[model samples]
Target: MRKEGIAKRGEKNKTTIRKILNYISKYKGMVLASVILAAISVVFTLYIPILIGQAVDQIVGPGQVNASALFVILKKILVVSLITAGVQWMKNHINNRVTYYVVEDIRTKAFNHIQVLPISYLDSHPSGDIVSRIITDTDQFSEGLLMGFTQLFTGVTTIIGTLLFMLSINPVITLVVVAVTPLSFFVARFIAGKTFTMFKCQSETRGAITALTDEMLGNLKVVKAFSHEQEAQKEFEEINERLAGYSMKATFFSSIVNPATRFVNSIVYAAVGVIGALFAVKGFITVGQLTSFLNYANQYTKPFNEISGVVTELQNSIASASRVFELIEQPALKEETGDSCVLGDAQGYVDMQHVAFSYEADKKLIEDLNLHAEPGQRIAIVGPTGCGKSTLINLLMRFYEVNSGTIKIDSMDTRKITRESLRAGFGMVLQETWLKSSTVRENIAYGKPDATEEEIIRAAKEAHCDSFIRRMPEGYDTVLGEDGGMLSQGQKQLLCIARVMLCLPPMLILDEATSSIDTRTEQKIQNAFAKMMEGRTSFIVAHRLSTIKEADVILVMKDGNIIEQGTHQELLAQNGFYTQLYNAQFAR
Candidate 1:
């Protein structure tokens, strides 16, 4: 089982590394430069100890040693060291540049992909997971890529070169030092493998904590209203404790690696010293040669330790990379066909034939429904909660796919039309209007980003929001708080209506659009709605029959099927579902 688990982990690591490589491919020139500089720096570092050994041998030799020659050698060594430092500095600079650019590219791709994902994907995934992908996952790539490659490359090169030089100096001492290499590697690998699992657990636990916090903060109003602050705090504390436990486990395993490697290294060094002394005393090797061998032994051990350290970091980074790659690997929403139909000068005729849909396959939400609306018609859909009134609008907008049916606009199948073009021809105003924190003019102009001030003012006027907006402290220039917190629900809804009006689409959808406003404001909004729907098709989904009294058609839906359809008066006369619904509300 452990072998199987290790295989799975290795495969995951390979996949994630491939993705990281692909990201780096975009900046090939910079990466190439960094690699070249890193190689040069490593070669110079190895040369330093060899030069020191040479200086020591010359100084201790019987032949006259010229001070000037020694000075020249020292100067040359200093220059080489400076050059190596310069290369290293440049490598770091280029690595950071590449890291930042690659990170930016990944972030942009993730965000853009999220925007294009089908609504069903968002419905299935938590918002916190998505946020973690953008923030935490990307940050991991940034941190790892910046230093992981340079360290791995340089450490390997330095170790190999030092080993070769040490072997050339005295093969016996080199053998003694090399004997401990495998043991060090085994210890490092064991600790790294265990720590990696802990790190993965830590990351998952952190994501859960983030999700819980986001949920609580998002519903702060409800929590406060119900006096549930202590409950929330307790929940948060539980998550926090879970995160801390996992973090400590990961840190403990990581901390063991260095100490274990260092202890083994000390033992190896002691063995090398004893073996060198024996060789020198037996006249098998000279004092100078033994000294050089000892230096090389120390050199080898240091890089070995450094390599072990790098490996630990690399393992942690691989864990993070796996998470990031998993997110990127999710199937993106299918793109619109190249030859998809486009809505141009459409008359807003809509038809649904044998329509069926389900959020999940076995649990259908809407089934075998049929409906039609002609140009310039007003239709209202009414039903109890969970009766799929909103689901119908969702299908119309192609937010979710129809299971086994067809929906057409202006005689063009929706499946054959691009999603952007299909949605472009409709104006939507929902019950909870979402406004960004921006100036009033910016919010109103969201429907038409390039709209002029005059056009903005006209849309606001048409929505009956101009009078109140004009009285605001800064009029159109006022900055709204997040989600339009500074405005009343009625005012926010009005702004949303104005935003839709600015688009001037051929078809309009008002989903409980007036449910938040006062009766007087609802009347005014209804008047504006009637004006806007004068020459366009409209669909109003409402629970209150009074709001749809003037609709040309009323459809009563239940259990994903339409049970009644007719004019308001006709439905009332029939005394069926629609009639009963109306009577119940009127009686109340």
Candidate 2:
């Protein structure tokens, strides 16, 4: 009853198979080419059995054989076998190309869809889980697809071709052969039905283990620091144990399919051999024809075994594809459906009137909130944890939409403005810094990619990171690893600060921008920020009360409401929540 995709439990596999076929249809020319080659290879292969039966018949009297006729048949067999091998190789190559191309398209679309998904979707889903669907599941799907493409068409063609050849020799025996084939189908179908769910469960379990591995590896330092390594390992083993069970059950079911079909196929082979011998004894068919009929029966039954194996693999593939399509089908962030308004030349004025919002509808976090920032003012928001300070920053940047009311920038409704243009004018630095695997200079100039070397150096100097950059072996060109590898937390924070400094947008949002830096370095960064904020409207969200003493306006918030608003000294004089918080931070 478990569901991995948008469809209901019973309908998921069929829907995924149809979608996968749609993708395969995109490369019809290649698939058709592969099919043609498969057909050619099968025909040549089937003809070899006929030639083989003729050769068997020609050796009637041992040394008194017709050597010339036998040699001609042998030559035909050799030529036909060589042709079959060549064509089979070509077909395999085409199948390989088509399978990977389909996978490539699916992967590209999945990744592109991820970029436009809503913030809430990303927030709710684990990063490791998303990565597993895109990477691990996609790979599993490709393996299944490749197996399908390689065997599926050839098996079908061989079955039909061998059947036609057998029918030309004897109708009664062919009917008997055809009747027994259904048993194989029924057995394979019954086993396949049981295996799909297990394979799907196995695929899901693999993703869970991959998610755990990714989480543990990314935060290994934290695990060691907290002495939680053993706990993490235990948790991993439990998930891994489940994965093992699912895999074994799936393998067990799928493995029996070929042998089970072959068991049925053996019955068909026995019926053909015995019936053909009776016909030969009565001289109703020639010895050579009887021999060819028996060979044709064996050839015809072989594809059932192969096809059953294909069914097993396809089940696994469909399960993996279901997981992948689930990601690609997720609803994207609502785009600008109406005419989008442009916010040109932001003048550092922002207003929020009657703004009401919540992460969950039942719980109102920010209700009937109002704020106004005049041009060139420093508005520092001070609040305790969960007081909606960072949430306010998210609203300003339009990371989340307001549930009710309007937030305007430069007197234009923010909802009307294109998100790209609206957010482009504001430079933001959050406490958690992010840097890609690139050079130090590249990280500094991230916000303004085209900034000159002199400009980047000046920004780094202003942000107090230029000293460390010069000491590195490659100076500004030093290649950073993932998330500023080898750099301390403070150094990474400084690089992020330099990024915002390089752009120096019309407005700024700094949420504890200097929390990682030492006191002396923080003072230098604050001085840089002051210069940067001189003519820009800025919203500063700070937990440290000592950081925002000179703000033009201080907003003290509690339980999602701004209870006090004044200059820092005025708030202290009033002796309210702000004073109490300031005292708590400095308390011995």
Candidate 3:
């Protein structure tokens, strides 16, 4: 079973590499130019050694030293050197440009695809894992591709050019180099196969560390409150050590390839020198040819050594590329069909008829449910945790499609309306507030990017956030840290509320929007919300009973069904679950 798993992984990696190569082929023009320039450079460089050998023969071959001939040969060498330098520079420039642009395209596509990915995919995966594939893995793949482009043409050309020269001088010595070349290939392949697995593990471990860092630091307040720093540190240490181990093992194996190849090449080099001398003594080969052959033999094997050194980095690149490709290939949310309706001028009427849903297939959360809300009605949903309150909100917003149900908004099936258009009609402020790193004014005006300064101030005032904005050092212009870390929880919630207020959507959903504020501030915000909710349909999910006492209709939900729903006074008169919950909050 273990062997079969490893074999399967190897096959998958091979497929990933093929896909990456196909992706690179999209830039055929730049790639062809890079190859041509690299070929020119290698050919020019190889000509230098031949010129030197000719110069040596001119000066020392059974005649008075031919100074004129040697000088001409030296001049040719200089010209070749200059041309090789120019071609190499151009090749590297094109190679790097192609690498960066290809990586940028992949990164952009990956980021955009993730935006339309199913919400369930995001819920199941850690953010760090997704982020690692976007940033770190893409970087590794680009670096490897750049290295491959720079070296691949030169390595192949150099080997072939050197081998042909060696053969012309003497087939016997050329055979010696050829016979030993397989040893280098064997060593590289053996080590590289092992390092590939190790490097893949290292990449995964690195992502795990990133996830832990995101979790620990993002929740530092909770970690400190619970005095869990020691535990967190220990968990990080274990993950770090495991990453270190994988890295060390990969390094150890990859490092062995270089020396092993060099060892075999050295033996071949020594044998060529010995045999060439014997051939020279018998006059089977000229002294200059022997000199040239020796240089070519060294050149022939150098590419192998260079390639062996790059094997580990290439393996790491492949591992990272595999991860990135896997993410890019993930099944995204289906696109809107051509016939999908575009919602316009919503009336805020919503209905859920015989809705049955579940996050997991077998564990049904909501079943046989029916609900309705008329225009401009305040529908309050009061339920215990995990009773599908937020899930219902998710369904309404199309964050998650229902398992088996039809949700109609303003007399049109939600499935028919485009998600963007349907979501545009509703303003949502959840218990978990989200604020980007930007100025307070920008955060408040997020829902309406073109909101004027006066409009922003008015919305802030309505949400009761203007007073705090005025107290800030830069007022509304003050830049916030990530997720508005510089502000208090209540302040952040108010900014979110202000954003929603600026949009003035026809429908609103507030899931404990004021749960973090003090009672006095809550009362003020409630008054502001009352003014905002005058003619708009709204859904309120709250745990605080007092907040919903005046709601036009209250839904008493347990598990997933609404056991009772009515005006607040009518439910209280019955003295049932609603009364028990309402009295429980005040009984404290």
- Using TM-score, give the best candidate's number: 3
Cα shift from native, residue 192, model 1 (Å): 1.8
Which portions of model 1 show Cα errors greater than 4 Å? 58-66, 280-292, 471-474
The residue-by-residue lDDT of candidate 1 on 289-334, one tens digit each, is 6776777777777776877877777776777767666666678778
* TM-score to true structure, per model: 0.94, 0.96, 0.97
Query: Candidate 1, after superposition: displacement of residue 220 in Å?
Result: 0.7
Quote the positional error of residue 449 for candidate 1 in Å.
1.4
Best by lDDT: 2
TM-score of 3: 0.97
User: In candidate 3, which residue ranges exceed 4 Å CA deviation?
Assistant: 1-3, 61-64
Tens-digit lDDT track of model 3 for 361-464: 97989887789999899999997888889988999999988888789998898989999999999999999999999999889988899999999999999999
lDDT of 2 by residue, 389-504 (tens): 99999999889999999999989889899988888889999999999999999888887889999999999999999999999999999999998899999999999999999988
Q: Clash pairs of candidate 2?
A: none
lDDT of each candidate versus the true structure = 0.85, 0.90, 0.88
Model 2 / residue 212 / CA error / Å: 2.0
